[model samples]
Target: MDLTNFLKTGTYLKLKVGLSEENIYSCFKKKDLSKKYYYNKLDKNEGFSYFYGDGALEIMVIDSKIYSLQFDPARYPYILTLFNNIIISHKTSFELIIKYLDIADIKWSFYQRYCHSRELTIKTEENIFIGCVYDKGDYKLSKFQVFEDLYNGFF
Candidate 1:
């Protein structure tokens, strides 16, 4: 199955936040996914990680429920669409993302860059989280992530 099938209009794979691991796995029975344990430093939650398309797609299941989804722009650059089909490429800048969201009237806030080349995060009113990086004096797209809840570390 195309990894883009994981991305939907409202939620990732149409799976609601906090869906059990069993149900999530049932939906991907036809796909070959590899699982491993991952400790997310941002959320500080250790969960079962299932990767697809050779690390292009990843979903973190915490406590046997869907917790987070991460998409690598480098591999599947054209597949990451958001906020009502706003298409974005790997080259999409942080400014462009803000511009798109602002035009859509979607409320969002800058989390931080932390330091050079680090993940600069933005959280939308709809609970969508975007991760970017500072590169060559511009914030380039790093990864797009959807989590079950806001990171505890975020203020």
Candidate 2:
């Protein structure tokens, strides 16, 4: 009955650890106007950086199959917002993390000195972690991140 097992097994945009660039591109929009990507020989991977609404997606692939991805914070005027039926950027928020994670229920250790804490990492029921890091002086959230266990045997 562990929810992490079910949640961690899921994919983003139906794109899993072994999906190709063509397979991934097929599942989402093809708006090259906002599409920006590159290939890194050192990593031996291709990267695509695409905008979604005011947010963005950065996908990385090696030998043609994706192994990692990221979602930027939610934004307004949502356009090309569908990443998957389960996870999303626009729906992502600190409150959303608490609703789905409830790390506090597990007695999980986290830091939140106040409403303006600089950073926080909440371990999720999915065995993944989502965080928002802030700029120190102004305490402005500078980054939104999702950390997932990397696929084994896949670099």
Return the top candidate by lDDT: 1
Worst 10 residues of 1 by lDDT: 1-10
Q: Can you write out model 1's per-residue Cα lDDT over 1-155, one digit (the tens) per residue?
A: 22233332225555656778776666566366765646775664666688866776677888888787777776652365655466676688789878777776767787653334466788666656677877677677877676766454433
Q: Backbone clash tally for model 2?
A: 0
Compute the lDDT for candidate 2. 0.44
Error of 1 at 66 (Å): 1.2
Give one digit per residue, the lDDT tens place, for model 2 in 38-76: 565355345544454455445555566665555444443
After aligning candidate 1 to the native by TM-score, how far in Å is the CA of 3 from where it should be? 12
Q: Specify the highest-TM-score model's number.
A: 1
User: Each candidate: what lDDT?
Assistant: 0.65, 0.44
TM-scores of the candidates in the order shown:
0.70, 0.51
Question: After superposing candidate 2, which stretches have Cα over 4 Å from the reference?
Answer: 1-9, 39-54, 79-96, 103-118, 125-127, 135-155
In model 2, the worst 10-residue window by lDDT is 138-147
RMSD of 1: 5.2
